[model samples]
Target: MSRAIEVILRDEIFTELEIEYPDDRNTNLLEQGMDSAGFLKLVVLMESKFNIAVPDEDLLFENFSTAGLIIHYLTEKTMS
Candidate 1:
């Protein structure tokens, strides 16, 4: 799921920024280059691709900080 999310982020969200996917899954994307707009794009893409609605409460930075966190959040949501 993380791999797929990486592909979507690279191909769709980060394409305009020309930002490469980091080698470290734990890397903070915002620190690297991602802006608020890019972060929102990622959230929207995740919703569309995963068919999951991210609640307002889950909009915290921690949940969207890294690839692994995003995958884990979605996995937890689906499991619930």
Candidate 2:
């Protein structure tokens, strides 16, 4: 997987938001503050790093609600 998203995401988004991963739990990110912009940025970053084209439709809450989830999705996508 591309560490680009993880590095940028952690250093940029989480730090800027002053959000520490409180618990080992959280699935719904939109409820927190990761709105459409974050989702769109992530989609772009992933696409660029992986050399894959991710349709805008894939940038849904169900797909990118969390970093781990996003990683999982990308792993699956790149392999198949």
Candidate 3:
């Protein structure tokens, strides 16, 4: 799941948002300079590629500021 998230992030959002382990990517993307469009694009790609529905509430910066959050959500979705 982390790998998939990383691919979507790197390909759809930032070319440099590398995530070897989703749990380790605690960086605040917005604080670091990522824009809103990039974040939305990643979310869209993630929803399509992973077939996981992300709630509207999950669109918050706190929910997807890092790869770890993405993986955590995806992992939970895949498991369920």
Candidate 4:
């Protein structure tokens, strides 16, 4: 799932943003050039791709701050 998320993120968000960065899970997405709009789009895309709804309370920076975090968040949400 993490690899799939990474590929989608690279193709959809990072590539669109023209960002160049390693595929490090701990890499900070915001630091890598993802902006507010990109983040929103990512959230929407994740919800759609994973078939999971991210609750309002879970919409925190800590949850989506990095690629790994987003994958982790989705794993938890979907598994629950």
Candidate 5:
């Protein structure tokens, strides 16, 4: 599942943001040129792709700061 999430993030980051996904999953996306719009696009994509609703409280920069973090957040979401 984490692998899948990483792939989706890589593809979407390239497709939607027109930016290369960092090789390091722990790299900060905001520092990599991911802006607010890109972030919202990712949130929507994750909801649609994973079939999970991300609560308002979970929509934090820390949660989506990197691919690894997103995978971790989604893994926890899917587990519950």
Candidate 6:
């Protein structure tokens, strides 16, 4: 699932956002040209693709700051 999420994020979300997927999954997306619009797009894509609604409280930078973190968050959300 983590690999799948990484692929979608790299091939779909990042492409739509016009941002390049970093070589390092732990790279900070905000530093990689991900702006507010990109972040919103990411959230929307994750919700639709994962079939999970992200609560407002989970909208923290730590949860979405990097690809690895996003995958981890989605993994936990889907499991619960």
Query: Model 4: residues >4 Å from true position, as ranges?
Result: 1-21
lDDT of 6: 0.85
lDDT of 6 by residue, 5-69 (tens): 77887898778778899999899998899887778888998898779999999877778998888
Q: What residue runs in model 3 are displaced by over 4 Å at the alpha carbon?
A: 1-24
Candidate 1 residue runs with Cα over 4 Å from true position: 1-18
In model 3, the Cα lDDT at residue 61 comes to: 70
TM-score against native, each model: 0.73, 0.60, 0.67, 0.73, 0.85, 0.88
lDDT score, candidate 5, position 4: 75
Worst 10 residues of 2 by lDDT: 17-26
The runs of at least 3 residues in candidate 5 whose Cα sits more than 4 Å from the true structure, single-residue gaps closed, are none
- lDDT of all the models against the reference? 0.72, 0.63, 0.67, 0.73, 0.82, 0.85
Q: Across residues 11-31, which tens digit of lDDT does each residue of candidate 1 receive?
A: 765565556666787988787
Locate the minimum summed-lDDT window of 10 residues in model 6. Answer: 1-10
Candidate with the greatest lDDT versus the true structure:
6
- RMSD, each candidate, Å? 2.6, 3.9, 4.1, 2.4, 1.5, 1.2
Candidate 3 lDDT tens digits, 25-49: 7866665566777677767767776
What lDDT does candidate 2 reach at residue 74?
70
The CA lDDT at 58 in model 1 is 85
Index of the highest-TM-score prediction: 6
How much lDDT does candidate 5 score? 0.82
